[model samples]
Target: MKTFRLMSQIHLWLGAAFGVQVMLWLISGLAMVLIPIESIRGEHLRSDEPTPAIDWADRALPLAEIIDGQSLTVLSARTGMLADTPVWRLETPAGPVMVDAIAGQSLTPVSEALATQIALSRQIGLGEIVSVTSLDSPPREAGLSVPAWRIEFAAGETTPPTTFYINSRTGELRAVRTAAWRIYDIFWGIHIMDWSSRENFNSWWIKVTSIIAILFGLTGVYLTVHRLWMMARRRKAERLGGGGS
Candidate 1:
């Protein structure tokens, strides 16, 4: 009886301490599962333009000539398009550099007009350019690296506000974030208890709350089993006393 009482007390106190966190975890987990990851990422909103075929017959400049004057150690090079123009994109020890394939001229530090055009080309729905900002540091989103252009778009009521991060030097579409993604991020932050970064799942607060929740569940189980055992004992005692009388 004393053990049962102690278990009940432990269960009650633990539940009181960690109930809100447990509820938050269950609700947030359900929400995350119900919502498709692609929807949260706003993939349906993007319209990827087909890559234009490179015309090799057009007397294109040699890769050596493009990098002749530049004092950059080339790590890798690939041919791709910057907006509508074909260029040789190079990864160097310093940073990414783009060279015009035909003119053999370097195209580093992409202009705002090009970035806006790139963002508009990738979007599908009705949206106007809200703002364009250059960022040297990563935003709240996870995949975006530094030295990029953040192009914001104000879409219709049904669609969420969208932001595209394009690599300034390589002109690569790095990441696309939307209002839905932000909503998911908020719940994720609450679920993980990493309010600041919204990424860390191994924080001390989460660990403590998890431990308390576990203890609460175990104590409740113990109390239930003890109560059943006590009830069985009482019934047996009554039956034996009646038989003796």
Candidate 2:
């Protein structure tokens, strides 16, 4: 009886000590299993359409200089549908922007809107989840042949992170929600958050908490087995003529 009581007390204390940590692990693990990181980020938006035509490679203005004010970073050029027509591709704060070299005209206004969506998606990552991407499917249209290139914005360490696709011909913006590259974002988010992002996984506190929780589980199991053995012995002794009626 005394041994049983001691073991029970140890089990109780271990459970109490590690209860919160165990609960956290359970909750976070369940969340990850049920929810996809992409659904959490946002939905994919895609559109395809032919852009208005321009003379092949004839617009003589400085395409790079025109987009300088829109937070343009990476800039490149390619030949358009027509011979000698230059298709200008640029990365900007909003997203990617495409311009016509021959006509010296902006192709589409995808940059501003795309940048806004991506920014909103990141902010949503901070627990401000809105189900904006719940549309059944992204509307699809015909493909254009001006010039085509894909751009990827850095999705900080998670699977299915927000990505942008730019059509150099029409300057269209398509948010890429699913692909092989998206898996990286999921893993990254999990690693960075350490299964508990609210407390910031980069802190020393979580490391200590995790270690303590593991110890609690191990100790609790040992105490349980010890109590079971003592109970079995006591019951056997009682039956072997000591308390046999």
Candidate 3:
């Protein structure tokens, strides 16, 4: 009985303190489920055009010349298209960079025209270009650490507005965001209790809430079983008393 009372107290306090949090979880989880995962990935908006092949073996410049006297310590390198041009994409301690494979010139900080072209040629969907703008800091939606070119596109009435982020320097496709994706992202952020940076699931707030949630679950289970047991005992006693009468 004492244990039952303690369980009741814990359950009530848990509901008082964290019921709202649990409700938010339910709402967000439902929202996420209602929105298809493919939509979140912006699959419908992705460009149907196949990517252009790189001219790597023959015409493209050699690795040494691409690095040359820049004193660059090439940590990683690969060949890919930059706009219509073949280029060497590199990862350095400083940051990621790109070089024209044939011309052997740096393509870092590609011009706005090039960024727009990149968005046009390699973008994922049939979106008409809406606006091309630069951001000093990446938007939370982009999920990037570097500044980027924000390209807005207007799709048909059936589809929501979509934005693509291209690395301002490397011109790499960074992330895709649409109305559904953005809403889903918000719900996801709330679901994880990391409204500030939706990507972080390991925050101290989450840890504390997790402990609270576990306690709530355990106490609620105990309270429920105890109630059922008491009801059963009451019915048994009533039957015995009636039989004696």
- Candidate-wise lDDT, in order: 0.81, 0.48, 0.81
- lDDT tens digits, residue span 191-220, model 3: 998987787889987898888889999998
Q: Relative to the unseen true structure, what is the Cα RMSD of model 3?
A: 3.3
Clashing pairs in 1: none
Model 2, backbone clash pairs (residues 3+ apart or across chains), number = 14
Candidate 1 global CA lDDT score: 0.81
Candidate 1 residue-wise lDDT, 121-160, digit = tens: 7787847888999888857683666578988889856787
TM-score of 1: 0.87
TM-score of each: 0.87, 0.39, 0.80
lDDT of 2: 0.48
Compose the digit string of candidate 2's lDDT tens values, residues 1-245: 67656666766776776676566556656656565654543443222333435553345556556555344565554433211235565555555565655565565543444433433433322322223321122322112233333333444434333444434334344345444434444444444444333325666656766676676666677777876887998889888967666
Which portions of model 1 show Cα errors greater than 4 Å?
Answer: 49-52, 156-158
Model 2 poorest 10 in a row by lDDT: 134-143
- Model 2 residue 175 CA deviation (Å) reads 8.5
If candidate 1 were superposed on the true structure by all CA atoms, what would the RMSD be? 2.4
Each candidate's root-mean-square deviation in Å? 2.4, 12.8, 3.3
Q: Indicate the residue-level lDDT of 39 in model 3.
A: 76
Among all windows of 10 consecutive residues in model 1, the one with the lowest summed lDDT is 49-58
